[model samples]
Target: MQLPIKKTIDSVPGGMMIVPLTIGCLINTFAPDTAGFFGSFTGALFNGALPILAVFYVCMGSTISFKTLPRVAGKGGVLLGSKILMGILCGVVLGHFLGEVPITSGWFAGLSTLAVVAAINDTNGGLYMALMGQYGTADEAAAYSVMSLESGPFLTMVTLGAAGLSAFPWQTLVGAILPLAAGIVIGNLDHKMRDFLSRATPVMIPFFAFALGASLDLHQVWQAGLLGLALGLFVLVVSGIVMLVADKTTGGNGVAGLAAASTAGNAAAVPTLVASANHAYAAAAAPATVLVAASVIVTSILTPPLTAWWARRVGAKAQL
Candidate 1:
């Protein structure tokens, strides 16, 4: 008999990433040396988050076409700029108060500028497209073509640097983007290559997510629960308002803007990646990862209804 394993996981918001991550966290917390006991490819899987993420970024880049850029530039650019600007604004303000370190006590323990920025900066591209397809114009859905630029940690790194919290080397920044840049070049040059590589994007999420989880303790994940929920609300309300204004100013109904407010599942990987680049963020990475993962689940659940409500409030017709 066939089991409902995949179906069960699919029932939860961001479960594909979150479930495996939780499993990894359980293994790491209880049996930390399991990798050594089961040395070889199994160990590699437990220790290979970064390399997997690098490949995942390339696959993500392959999905973004240079051709789509010009077509949806106006709507897409406005949404993209608004999202990034909001993330930077929050990062700068929090960095001013929190610096690069996370809170270590009380209800807000584990909160950090890094977590805030990472959660707020990335949009859930898959969710945006689905919502826009249902309640917005074709152009609105296409707008994610530009927003996809926020796929990895590059924007978070820049926002943190701008906040004066950490300074990444010029080479570090270049190294961060090189895989994505290479994917874009190859994708643009060959349609078949683009198709082939882009298909691997979803396939890589669980692998890297599991690896990322292996690095964290359940205690940190447990502590981040409330803060992550609060951060998700902040992303939806603050980023939603900014993106709404942006969409309206660009001759849209604000549905697209609201749709763009959710955090992507892949965004959970950003803190770990950022920490790897700048040790200053290392203290914040594990908690930040949990926080971002929480944001992913929180936003994924809330955004659909929020988008639908906004579409109705503004009299935007559902395309369905």
Candidate 2:
């Protein structure tokens, strides 16, 4: 039997979640103690739902072939580097600007730096590739390009973890490496295995996104005060600058900055770990977590067209 689709489904993936989450946060401002209501919901959903996302990532990896690795190397390097360095550079510029904004405390300043960084989520990266019609190529360029983003989140996690560690915490990285290695092994197996996992991943993606969105406190938007607004505007301006600079330099691989802008989010995994590592910033942890969530939801909506526009302007092969 065919099930009827609700009009609300459109709001689920589109702008509906953003409005509610913002509203949730604002509700928190009136009863400062109530901020935890939305925040805890977010924490439960993201923290609880993330392991499933990890499993999806592992299954997606199960499909990789070693032959594709080299292709990811030559041209892929330039493309991937453009995404990373451009992000870092933009981050640095914003960091410098915020250095003067006194809205954040010393600890918050640290977490915000982490927040601006981007990582390659398998779900978003896959969507980006398909949109750009980059699914199959000599380099498996899209997949490889994604791996570059994939690795950075962990790196960002570790770096943020360091705010209190005083030195690189090899132990945390070591802990994450085993599962990653295991995933790579499974990801490189028989094609059937990879294919099965790939199919399963898409079905699971939205549930997580929706659940994550439901957890956000929309009320925070109002309570976030002037500082959050200032920061959000900074992200918009810096992201635009990145697109302009990248177009000039990369011979134009298509304007990805706009796509990058809409989807600009920290690796969802970073905050809880960072908070655990540094006790002082536990308060900043909730806000950082919400900010990343909002960015992900907002940016996901913004990326498609913004990317297409940039793609046409630069005459790049992909919309990216």
Candidate 3:
């Protein structure tokens, strides 16, 4: 008997399942109780696979020379910084206005930071480069993608916490930064492992996505009605405006298309890390994770068209 290798979800990059998986989640409105329809095991895949694939993408460019980091960081640093600043601003404003109604400090921080995080995922950008036939835009996104691995969390915690949207823990900060350092090490020294993980990570996506969708009371995304619809529309409109401005400023580096399609989402890490520091927020963990999970599925579907449209408007071509 021959041993068989399973061709699970990992074999497909941008697959058929993503659409229904992403949009079906919105059905939580009509179904109200239908969250997690994708199941735990499938949810687990979404949770675990994203970061692994992220690291794998990083490894692909390790050979470009470590020295380029400064340049990469310099140019990409602005994008990351902008993300953090915008998140902080939004979190603070939303928190203050809502004033502990449906809003908690963590709520503000979570959603705000998530906006930026959701808007961008370093790993996803890298994966896009790997699978989507690298173009100038992909490379441009990849350049900054490396910087975002650590920066996303760092910015979220640092800015949000410091701004008082959430509490910041010294120990957790130290711990979180370690993975980024490790990512750099792995990115440079273990390209093969990085590649392997990237390839393997997709297997976990569905599981991750399903779990997040399960948390919401579909009624909230629906019965809450106009607010929920407005929220989604606001996110889209705001993101588009940001993309246009970025495109103009960057001389159409194609970074705008990438930035427009950031879509990293906070994933499990956002709530998990925040909850680790602020025990009061433990309940929010699931929602935060799910929010990010959904963001990714949606972004994956939205990014290509958004990027192309932005690219055309700005006259930028794909870089990587």
Ranked by lDDT, the better of candidates 1 and 2 is 1
TM-score of 1: 0.98
What digit string (tens of lDDT, one per residue) describes model 3 on residues 100-200? 12333432433434333333322244434432353344345445544445333555566556545656678877665655555556656776755654454
Cα lDDT of model 3 overall?
Answer: 0.46
| Tens digits of per-residue lDDT for model 1, 1-320 | 99999899889888879998999999999999998999899999999999999999998888888988999999999888887888788888999899999998999999999999999889999889999899988888888988898889998998888877789998989888889988998899999999999999989988998998899899888888888899888888888889889999999888999999899999999999999999999999989899999999989999999999988998988885
Q: Tens-digit lDDT track for model 2 on 1-320? A: 85534445444433333443344445444443542556676545433545654564565455556666664454444444555564455445545654212235542333355455532221245334544463123333343443433431454544433322223357756644444455557657666666667577545445444444344455433344444444444554555565445434544353443443434322443444445544544554555556555455544655666666666666656423
- TM-score (C-alpha, index-matched) for candidate 3: 0.63
Candidate 3's error at 103, in angstroms?
Answer: 4.3
Query: Model 1, residue 174: what's the lDDT?
Result: 87
In angstroms, give how far residue 150 of model 1 lies from its true place: 0.7
TM-score of each prediction: 0.98, 0.65, 0.63
| Model 3, total clashes | 32
The 10-residue segment with the lowest total lDDT in model 3: 98-107
